[model samples]
Target: MDNAGSNQDKGNGKYAGKFPKIAQQTRLLNILVIFAVIYTLYLAKSLLVPLFFSAFVALLLSPLVAFARKLFIPRTLSAGALIVLLVAPFTFLGIELAEPAERWMQSLPKIAAEISKEIEEISSNIDAYATPPAEPVEKERSFFSWFGDDEKSPELSPPQDNTNSVTDKIKQSGIDIGLTLFGNAPFLLAQVLACIVLIFFLLVFGPNLFNVFVRDFPIVTNKRRTLVLVDQIQRELSSYIVTISIINSCLGLATAGVFYYLGIDDALLWGALVALMNFVPYLGGVASCVVLLVVGLVQFGLTSSAFLPAGLFLVLNIIESQLITPAVLGRSMQLNPLIIIIWIAITGWLWGVVGVLLAVPILMCFKIILENLGVFDHWIRLLESK
Candidate 1:
């Protein structure tokens, strides 16, 4: 027994000596894996962005689809119907806003010119009041002046027509943009079609698909765990999406009312724009403010009243973000503000605008998975807001 104990101790000691090295290797491997995953996401964004969006849409509509199925509706028919219903509002909104949006686009150059004029006026006013620096007197040089080296100087070219150059450049830019859009139109259409199709399939088959996934798990324990995890994720995501949608809708209405009260043209358009932008958290809020500010400046000029719309929106946003959102979402959905910002930045860097939009949902997903796995407790704590 003593000899057996001694051998056991020897075996442990040998492993203990190698343990640190193994741990270092594991950590290195984890970092490499993370980098590889990020690179893969970046490269596949054209494919994955639509997939992620479709997944979210599927999650949001799956409950409705399931309910419809319970009433004896065919799952495939229900899925297709829901997808059409989902897109209908956006189509209607576009049709409604098209004229106003086009009008605004047409007026942009005039607005820009007005803004430039105001800036120039302000600069001229400042210059008028300020003392000008004295001009340096030029020293006349002789033909033989060695220090000036007049003979070595190149002959002056005729002044170029900057206006024509500018116009040509603008035309060229327009043509290039037109060509680029024309080139990508088919691909964009394909992606949209792909997303719609994927959403339909997911809505129709998502539950059965997940069940099959769980069934394929090697261990019964794993299967059960996965089932629970998937169920929880679906429930939580659906709840979050629905609640947020209602809140954004309400916010949009309020914004429209505010804009109308302020006599802002295209109030409904601005409201819709704000509502869509609000999905992106901090960045969205900032964008809304800038849009309101520009609209205010364009409509009301550079006076103090020009800030009214933006300031009011700022106040409304603060109330909504701090009070209404937290109350509606509850503590369970609360994420660490710092983590949220970092996640948004990382995802934005990885996948541009789509990444920024998907960041919160993806982070929530990871948080839920980690929680269910019963690991990374500290990391979960870090993810959860105070």
Candidate 2:
């Protein structure tokens, strides 16, 4: 009996010793699985990106579609109409901006030359003031130089025949551009078409899909919880999209007005670009300022006026990001800035520019889901102050 009891105690001791190692292995396995999933997502971006984009667009427009349905409109027609309405303004904006963009492209060489000249002049002035003169030293000829022939070796010149004809160069450039466009056009068109179709179907049938999804949960409480979660997510995401869109549109209009007052060319284009880029958070504001600075330098040279547009843009961005967004979004949607930055970096790495733009929304959705599920409550609390 004593021996048996000792054996049992030994067995218990061995089990206790192995438990931590088992737990550690399980944790390591989970982390590896997570990394593998992320790698798969990165590899499958071509197939997944359009789908994700379509889902976001669908969610954004779902409320509008719902409202339209309340007025007795068919879901199919309402979804189709909403998509068209959403696309038309963008198409119009593109049409309006095309000529100005082309003009800017044509003027690039002139702008570059002016910029280079100004830079050179500034550099010369800085060198004159800030750099001290170096003492001149006499050089001594080597023995090899003394032994060489007095006559200088013939200077090498580029072969005149090797120079490309202007027409040939132009033709080659045109061919290269045409080939590039031809290669990518089909893929881009296909993605756009896929997104549109997916969005339309999702809008028309999203509720039914949700019902079907919840029905598969196999428990009544789970189904109800999922339905509630879905509704909450849709409402919150749609509200966020609407609020941000209005704020961005206002920013764009204000920017346009400022540029117009400042006598900048292509004010509308600049405003539209600003509004579009503002969707990407920190990097977007920087990009807009840089673009304005470049345009300012190209248009006004090195004068004080060259700084005005960029300065105004920077001020406007500060107001919008610091004041307008917070007031509009309120504390409910607030997130840790550090976490947002990290999320942006990770998604941007995984999916490039689109990921950067979508990171905040995706993070918000994730937080909402996890918070509602009551999992990782402490982590979620840490991610938000309120």
Best prediction by TM-score: 2
Estimated TM-score per prediction?
Answer: 0.82, 0.83
What TM-score would you give candidate 2 relative to the actual structure? 0.83
The 0-to-1 C-alpha lDDT of every candidate, in the order given, reads 0.82, 0.83
Mind giving the per-residue lDDT tens digits that candidate 2 earns over 7-66?
A: 999999989988999999999999999999999989998888888899999999988888
Clashing pairs in 2: none
Supply every candidate's count of residue pairs whose N, Cα or C atoms clash at under 3 angstroms: 0, 0
Worst 10 residues of 2 by lDDT: 155-164
Residue runs of model 1 more than 4 Å from their true location after superposition? 1-17, 127-189, 217-221
Q: Which ten contiguous residues of candidate 1 have the minimum total lDDT? A: 159-168
Best prediction by lDDT: 2
